[model samples]
Target chain A: MDAAAETTPLLSVRDLRVSFALDEGLVRAVDGTSFDVMPGQVLGVVGESGCGKSVTMRAILQLVERPGRITSGEIRFRRDGEIVDLARLPPRGPVMRDIRGGEIALIPQEPMAAFSPVHTVGEQIIEAILLHGHRWGEKKLSRKDARDITVGLFRDVGISMPSQRVDAYSWQLSGGLRQRAMIAMALSCKPRLLIADEPTTAIDVTTQAQVLALLRDLQAKYNTAIIFITHDLGVIAQMASYVVVMYLGRVMEQGPVDEIFHTPKHPYTQALLRSIPSMTGTTRVALPVISGALPHPFNRPAGCPFHPRCPDVMERCSKAVPSLRPVTPTQLASCFLHHDQAEPS
Target chain B: MSDTAASPLLEVRGLQKFFPITKGFFQRVVGHVRAVDGVDFTVNEGETLGLVGESGCGKTTASRCILRAVDPTGGSINYRTRDGRTVDLATLSPAELRPLRAEIQMIFQDPFGSLNPRMTLLDNVGEPLLVNGMSNRNERTARVAELLRVVGLRPEFMHRFPHAFSGGQRQRIGIARALATNPRLVVADEPVSALDVSVQAQVLNLLLELQSRLKLTFLFVAHDLSVVRHISDRIAVMYVGQLVELAPTDAIFNRPLHPYTAALMRAVPPADPRVRITDGILGGEVPSPAAPPSGCYFHPRCRFAEERCRVEAPALREVTSGRFSRCHFAGELSL
Candidate 1:
């Protein structure tokens, strides 16, 4: 923890904005989102579907597809005491490519689609190793060396019998094993930062526990910074040290995990927390849901995006947008309820 | 909620569903995938029984068998009809079961796929009425409008197609369709799983309200334990097509009798960050249903398995007044 306080942040995103150019108009998928990922700590980006949690992560890696573009923001990444603006790098250039897979690797949501069916899992993992392994103070690694490294990574992710299982294709493996293989591929380069985008959502609950434990262990061992993106608040609570709450492509709240769970300031964050069914015998009653559906992106409401459903909407809530301001020393909220002179009732 | 006070609304005994695995040019019967093997449970009048398990655990198969959507390989599904007649759904012929179809209906998981894209909300909700000999268009339209109002949708929106509505609204339409025939039993297979978190609560509350208002009995099958706990009176835990534990919702979460149930309870990530899971993390993947382990099916992954558990299967036995378990050391273990 002291190392995190002393050193510069591993990755810093500032006021990031990403928009999609549809025929109708521009849809701001990610708007003015900012957060920091420190060394060896997990930052959870949480929101419902269409809330731009995934888009924010994609913007960091410069992987937003065609028709979607990162219009502005600075994604400054600190590597070897040098800062690089990732948002300025060309999307498919050599420097961006090396930074993407070599310095910051990703474990995508669907392992089935991410992996190739024709090649063996081991062969694909070895290719990743060879592609990025040259940066590890060595000119190059032999095929056997890459294979051994891949096997070691497989074993690290808790895949049993890596030597034999590595030869199996992606479809031949179960959902849990395929996800583990994907994690191994992400960790093959020993990257400084890992972006895990819903990596456990596809697997079963029991396998989810194992994979989460494996990630915590690996993060502790390597001191790798992680940006864990998920819609499940339970998952965010379990895995993340700091949390970012998003809604309608904007940051609603940002704080330490404990504060976010115990003392969420924004009405959107509070309503989202209350909406989840608790497991500890406290959720048999009806959950307090945020009423009304998320407004369509094209017809986004003026002023506060969440005022339509917010329980504590004031007169000022629907007139102008609220910028994120500090509600506490370590917590920020973008709601007028926190900034008003009167106490929130 | 007493099991013996009155006859159960639905009693399923020794239900089994097996799909044949074939290979080669002749497509010979090479093996069998025992999707649901000898599962038994009962749903009382106006009560919700949650059948929960991971993917491919046969909860869906059991529900489908109860509705007779898919013919069961064996066992009896004794359902007491609305007119107070007991009929074995598994043994009934297709011709004989046509009239009984109106008494049992299913609510699917995906609202988008289950609804017809071309049909308006009224047509989708009133199709069951039309098929069941309701020829009067005014009567069906009025009933559809009332049903739409009951589900919190505007009656005027009945003319719109499914694509015009949001996911939550479409789910409401599906519920309206399920209730069109006034079913005695509603088998909702992961009804709210496809909706978002905020919308999930809305649909769940609506289901609970309708269950009470209409006096409907439900067999809710879902993988999420928390959602099941919120809506179900009792829960039956399944593993590899077998009922590992059956108890009230509180007992299932508070004092799980079966090891699998206990492990599953621990596996659910708590919404509180302070509550970290430090012990009893389950290991290994769920064994394939095509070739399950011998003796006790969960023996390979059971941490408390003994030599006897490796060689002998444990029958489902009552551990308490209402709780049941399928463990060799059911009452002995503190789990």
Candidate 2:
């Protein structure tokens, strides 16, 4: 018999590579990325606009639109005492569809677009609950049970008068309420992993604070693992226990939150941290820029994509890509500067 | 020793813009959405006044009214022209306002949407110059090159379409167009909110440099307090279409007088893991402008609300020297 997969990560993405075939050339959106999401842990994916964090997330659920394919890699996930490779599952097949929204749910950046305009928010959530009812331990969710569950989720997300709000359309509610409704929908089937992609970008700061607080509380209560993808480092600091910094479709560094923020190893990580205009800085003191703009998607640089803007670039950095190596016990970085520590992959 | 205060470049008094809420097929007017309700402020010469507010809070509406992009329902926008001639822009006719348009310009938020797709950056930046009677194409091109160079973009890229440039580069082009006419007052509405953090710092630094170089007075409307703190000499806090607190940047950040201002400060996710938004996160959504709550519009969500706050509206009054607040107990609150 196989040994228990207890010590293994809840989700292990090993050398995951996703590429989009364009008319002009191939765009490697996620080039050789790897990370682990521990059970009930908050992992933040931070990067700039074209950094491919969103594509990586879409690939996890097999939702990356065609022309963009997961060319090579393994997405090993522990499910129901068995390990499954999500990368191999047919995107439109029953198994993948079941796992997409059933076990792993997604709250998109724009909740307004994610929801249907014709249906009431409550109806959509109820439909999700009814569809995934069988997966829930013992009882199947009936119509009445689904409605009650929808209302319960609403209340859990701190929507006032959940019973009345259950009938409201997505457009009728305020931006904050719409986001809360989206959260309720995502959590309807009790997903083990919640993927929030720039979830707080649309709302006001005050409402964003409320939502972040709510998400933290719910994560604690359900002990559900989360993958939060955003461009805001401030938000990452407040939310994640571990951080994955990406640049031009690759992971530059990964480590515990404190070490990542305090003492980043990769030059890209260091430059990104120094570039931000902090609240504590002397007013009007010009912040240091990363020197050059992001390379055009089609014209991505050879070897390390960040070598052009990297302050401590070596001659060999332009020749070949460096594999991620453990710089410290808990921290990992992909840079030629740390090549002496281990053999190049 | 104290230096003399700069003269007011523009003063807005009791600005109100009401959009009617229509219901039936006949478009029967139900009520009014007082988007910018009885607001007042002044932008001194060469000073950046940061107008801070959450969405639907009327900060955007108020800035638009000042620019006359959306005509206001009432109140006067007093402007001091170059020759020391004071004019009420609110009452100016189209012909009268045409020349003054060259004196004031705007920088928009979305860099992508603001620039024309078909037109090259040269024509896009030069359009304002053309409109203001810079008829000679050669002169316009020369001036556009100078403006582009001033904003830190390579002048050669002006011939290229906007799609060829990145978000940061596009925003610089937008700034160049806004400064084409040598406008004295620039109304930048959430200019850097659409940009990435690294790029935002670059833009902020450029704006700071340009402000001193050109002696430009700015009405910087933005939502981020930290960004506002970096750029503005004074900050105004708006809630439900009314100014709750207005003070120097340091005063508002260090010792906010109003509860709403204090709450807003707490909402900004501190970039350190040691700190988190634990308590006093404002509950409930912002009230709709169409049917705002009675008395103090913020009373329903305000943690410090009392019986009196629910019954009586508070007028924006000068609380101390160079400070203003609309809260009933502005001075007494420790926050």
Candidate 3:
């Protein structure tokens, strides 16, 4: 868990606590979540909606909205062998502005909302590139030069007829093309870490596969660490090297993708796997739903949040929250079963 | 497969829908966008036929045409109702179609947006019944409660408005509304695509359960292959307003003949992490529906496109007993 190993993590987030000041009380959106992403690693974050996966990823870039603040944790970002504490940086300061897109870039879920309706996609991309390029005292290029690079970036992201597409606004482009434009904009600055939050949710299956493959190839070529957030385990299988299972703002389990998919230890993870419609399995009588919806942010359980829905919940699960214990090599899970066997105090 | 004799509940042939593109203040018709062009398919009684494609590929338009929500410029929609009466739905006048509305219903994609926010859940579900002149409010409320239970929502939720519930709950309300009149055929347009993954399974399961219990025929439109495969007994693949492939679910998944279908299958990620994915095959975006490719619409991205494919529009022809494909080289491709 050392942050300074040979494979130094580009982004190391530990004990991240993000909460919202609601009318009733303080609601924990991301409670003590922790994970890491190394160079060229695609860390898949999977969860049901409202499980705080997006909130945890947003916390890294300090993008959490007002009234919902990061209460504790260190988002230690490594840039050019220099480590900077992201959580400690003052909001809107030069240090924060420099690292926002220069070192850490974000590809949001909904491209329709991400890009302005009036602005052409090329202008949006140029703005992102300028943010990073200007950090090194780079002069603003001519309009033609900016347009050329925008076209090039579009082509790099696999948009056919990039020149024609540069003139179109976000509304004119299809869902898949809009997402590709978002990816192009995110990667235009060439950040070390790319956080793609459900990039393919709106697009079709074919477009999703193409975009994912493009992201993988680009990750390899650029050696950019990625924190990919999605609900589809299928997409995770295709993109992630490591997998993180989240529930009710906590890390339910974390391990390598293969291990997590094949030999999932947590009941929640197993239920998730079983819920997926499989090509190999028998015709399902009924989809095995996870029994209940995710807990409301304000009414999160006192103990294990997943205990109510878990089929194999024990008596002790409802009393105390389980800390993430080491289950296997590079695998950790927060469950009462693990706590029972690994009790030391 | 079950050998039971089942009649076609709905038959659509050579269906075409074109929207005019007008420009400037003069409002001159610039060109026609053939949103749905020359599509044919049949849904058997008590079976789910999934229509799947990328957005703007005309699946939604085809469904809308079948329901006459958007009138088709050409072709036939023959519906055999529950009373053993066959009717050419397209030729019917507005007054004539009113009686048949109870036999066919549609569930829209955005459940929240589709339902009336001003109405209570009970009122939304009861609208269809009320429109059909079911005058008893008590009876309507009873039926709504029954539907709520059928869709796995609590009967008490009927009093609440759509904004009060979560996305999954709103979808269930939408389903209950669709089933209020006990329609023989329901067109569910991307029913669960709007919900979360976990909630999607729940809603899908609920739909499947309702279908079996009510013995309803379904036209399920979705873009997700895995979801379509799970619920659909038969599947249709569409591209640029054309039906490229149609077959049984397993047949389409295991032995898709059309190159476009094969490429689409290859594009979907496997559930198992251990499985190796074919590098994304078809490249480039779908051509404009307004002016599709002259020959085969797919030839632009098709890896196996030939000289003939680029010039000749392939027709949808039966390649096997129950499978249809539109590719000239479909015989050579393994699904």
Candidate 4:
């Protein structure tokens, strides 16, 4: 690693690829996707369903399941003055397990399914704390100490009556409270990086706003980096500093949040932004939508996956795949529109 | 859009639907959960009325009560039929209501669960027609093919089942089924909420086009403010089993009357990143319907709530020309 790379980013992924082995053929879930998450910054990954955003995050902590393998990539994570490649780590091994929850934690989409029904929410959080507390210098926390810590965590996430709520079962709590408990558990280890996969998608709008504010407050207090993954561009604009737009297993564009929203380079990104309904004006008009749907995974398109739906598609776009090249000083887009204007290496 | 000369297509007054909360093995009724309490609104001809609220706010209950899916406890649902006949749907008998069912149809939220797995798309969409005296199989097939074409789907693909289609396509199939009877008023409950953003736009556009072509009036129920604002001519904001505000879409977005409505408008995340939400963030959750707070249901969460709002419940009254609000200081407070 270079000196600048060593001191700058907390995690850097280069040319990452992940594929699922189906009965018919190989489904490239994530193909040649790369982005970096700096310390104390939230990186948002926005995409539609089946766009491989979730698969790429799953590949980061070595959590890819059976039939899905990280084919070739370099996920270099900086830890204690050492650079470790997470792509080659065995999923269930002891070292990877320690790094999975201790250094990198995940907050899943559905909180009801993530927590156990039989156990009280407090017990589950305590179990997580005990399992990973050693990394944070809490070697021997008794049951009482762990319970106290869990209560504190619940309070931190803006839950009312933390002591009473900690003992409540997952099914007893509402959707908003269940999500808050999930956030508390994810923060139990104080992981340097948190991967929140659509954490507020299932909740109400008011509750979503509250959760987003809470996340911003917690990130400022703990100084932890975040990888927020969602399909909502509105939430992305509110939460992330840097943004990455992904299509069918590929990075369509990546840049700062302001640039991606204000001056999008990729046709897919621009179209996606135009499709969202605006709240400022009360104009009863039809939204501008993309022409076609995402192609089937098994019957993937030849070159660019979005060429069929792209409004500014060229003849060459259907025949050749364009690599991610610089569109602006801070933005990069993988489109043939910028192929000729790109600066020479 | 507010045409005073033309009568309302459907008018609901003092609608109430309460489920008894029983206790112990004997199942004795102790109290009632007022799911739809005194909701009043009107859907004019060829206009969309958006009903919006958070979860557990009784929007679904009100829609279901209007359709008589669940028998309401008390209310008058006056629906004008195609032949210019007014009928009280809430008081109608089962046999008497069977014919009117074809005039008011419902489109459910989940396309996956709403469509039967074993049935083909043709049977699913054509079943309503078959039940309503269209017994000939060939005629039913022809009509089903035409309806599918209207929804932008291939007629040949009607032979395939719901499992062979995507979420958006299945939603289109649901729309086709809802439109099979040419209903005057269609009640759609979060129709496009389950689809992706790109597909949501497609479905919204389709709904807009169908409304114009078929001259259909809609009661579009959804939680998203932007989507509701885009399709609705007039919007009704609901809170704990009550209508807090009812006004034109532009009035509700620009000059809200109720505090709850103002907070709801502010809560929606703007599409532009530079627009920051400075104030009016709602706090706490909706109170339980069984034991809702006395006086105003939203006093606990409302920022401008005063002492009068805590002691006495406010009745929904007309505040301006075409706007109504349930707040005590509706016209006084510039929300």
Residue B284 Cα positional deviation in candidate 4, in Å, after optimal superposition: 0.9
Candidate 4 Cα misplacement greater than 4 A, ranges: A1-7, A340-345, B1-5
Second chain TM-score, each model: 0.98, 0.98, 0.97, 0.98
lDDT of 3 by residue, B150-257 (tens): 888999988988988888888888888888888989999999888877788898898888888898889999998888888988999999999999999888887889
lDDT of 4: 0.90
* Colliding residue pairs in candidate 3: none
lDDT tens digits by residue: candidate 4, A1-345: 466743488999988999999898999999888888998789999999999999999999888897999999889898888988899888888878888888899999999999999999999999988888786574687788889999999999999999999999999998889999999999998899999999999998998888888899999999889999999998999889899999998999999999999999999999999998888653567789998777778878877788999999888777878888888999999998987432122
- Steric collisions counted per model: 0, 0, 0, 0
Q: After superposition, how far is residue A264 of candidate 4 from its true place, in Å?
A: 0.5
The DockQ figures for the candidates are: 0.75, 0.73, 0.61, 0.72
RMSD of each: 2.4, 2.0, 2.7, 2.3
- Give the TM-score of chain A, superposed on the true chain A, for all candidates in the order listed: 0.95, 0.97, 0.93, 0.95
* Fnat, one value per model: 0.70, 0.68, 0.61, 0.65
What value does DockQ give for candidate 1? Answer: 0.75
Indicate whether candidate 1 or candidate 3 has the larger DockQ: 1
Query: Runs in model 3 with CA error above 4 Å?
Result: A1-5, A80-82, A117-119, A134-155, A159-175, A341-345, B1-5
lDDT of each: 0.90, 0.89, 0.86, 0.90
User: Model 1: clashing residue pairs?
Assistant: none
Highest DockQ, which number?
1
* Worst-scoring 10-residue span by lDDT in model 1 chain A: A336-345
Give the TM-scores of the predictions, in the order they appear: 0.97, 0.97, 0.94, 0.96
